[model samples]
Target: MPIGRADVSPPHWRKSSYSNGSGGACIEVADNLPHTIPVRDSKNPTRTPLLFTPDAWASFVTAVAIGRLAD
Candidate 1:
């Protein structure tokens, strides 16, 4: 689901630790909502965010943790 500014409540956005603070490849995630994980570009806060299901998000994170996404 696409999340517009008005579609979501106040989001507590957390930046990725891998972000070097160089204004490059930075993404923010808000997982406080039930059943959905919202992701947005850190540089473009005004834009709509992409929403992921909890299961999909967990699988993606697990793949990243195991370095399977690199292949």
Candidate 2:
């Protein structure tokens, strides 16, 4: 079941590992979707989520893991 924008009405969002318990900068990702990875700000879940292809999301995760996206 490929996920479309309209199909993401109720996503099961999970917080990023980088997120802290003190309500700091937090991002939530919904990978349960079939084809798309949905990302949203934990602080503002009602806002529209950003969608990414599974491959693109995997690449972004790899980059972040390898410090290629470090500040």
Candidate 3:
């Protein structure tokens, strides 16, 4: 049997630690993909996930952690 495109695995999405059970605002991230991290709104999983390179993702995470990107 030939392998099909749809046979590919889907991303394993995890909610951000900062997210709360109330669901006011939340984003899920898939860190399983090689060299890529995908993020999407938890309330809208069917939407296209935003892809980020490993390095870029790392930098963005660091900035957020240190409050450089905070409002």
Candidate 4:
């Protein structure tokens, strides 16, 4: 439900700092473009990424860091 036009410039994806050292199951995030954070699975780089607004991405990161998403 994002309203503004999403910047479509090619993203330079970077692996999460917390990713497994062996490149196992992990997520990559692209912070290059404006107003968007592109996230994709390392196991499937060719697949479309899930886009999140800056605010939303920050919130999600905070939640994860605080163990709010733990099972």
Candidate 5:
């Protein structure tokens, strides 16, 4: 199923730990939401967020953890 604009709530967000300290490559994630992962640009918090299924997010994290996404 495709995610629609109404599927996610407005949220308070935080930047990913992998983001550069200077804010380049900043990635923002919302907390306290169930069943979905909402991510946006830390530099543009007001923009529309990209939504991920929780399982997809988990797999992405696992890949990063195992060095699959590293340069």
Candidate 6:
């Protein structure tokens, strides 16, 4: 379940709602991955994806949304 390598396959991909419409810098998430959540750079969809637990991903997303974690 280690999709951190240079060639990971995402079953699905979804861009963040906060992504710039013009496509500057954006991050995407691929869910429905059972116990894991796959994340990748939209700018490089063909590359490796960072995997995380569903809870962890949710926490991160919540934190980001609430401004608890700053970029």
Tell me the deviation in Å of residue 14 in model 2.
0.5
Q: Which of candidates 2 and 5 is the stronger one according to TM-score?
A: 2
Descending-TM-score candidate ranking: 2, 3, 4, 1, 5, 6
Task: Tell me which residue pairs clash in candidate 3.
Answer: none
The estimated TM-scores of all candidates read: 0.80, 0.83, 0.81, 0.81, 0.79, 0.78
Better of 1 and 4 by TM-score: 4
Model 5: pairs clashing at backbone N, Cα or C within 3 Å: none
lDDT values of the candidates? 0.84, 0.87, 0.84, 0.89, 0.83, 0.82
Worst window of 10 by summed lDDT in candidate 5: 1-10
Candidate 1 lDDT, tens digit per residue, 1-71?
45553335677899988667789989999988876789999999879999898899999889988999884
TM-score head-to-head 1 vs 6, winner: 1
lDDT, residue 40, model 5 = 95
* Alpha-carbon deviation at 61 in model 1, angstroms: 0.6
Residue by residue across 1-71, what tens digits does model 2's lDDT show?
A: 43444454567889999889999889999988767799999999999999998899999999999999999
Q: What tens digits encode model 6's per-residue C-alpha lDDT throughout 1-71?
A: 45654434546888989889998779898886677788889999889989898889989999988999877
RMSD to true structure for each model, in Å: 4.6, 2.9, 5.2, 2.4, 3.3, 4.8
Say what the RMSD of model 4 is: 2.4
lDDT of 1 at 52: 91
Model 1: CA > 4 A from native: 1-8
Clashing pairs in 2: none
lDDT of 3: 0.84
Q: Candidate 4, TM-score vs. the true structure?
A: 0.81
How many backbone clashes are present in model 5? 0
Question: What's model 1's overall lDDT?
Answer: 0.84
Q: Write the per-residue lDDT of candidate 4 for residues 1-71, one digit (tens) a residue.
A: 36777687989989998789887869999999888899999989999999898899999999989999876
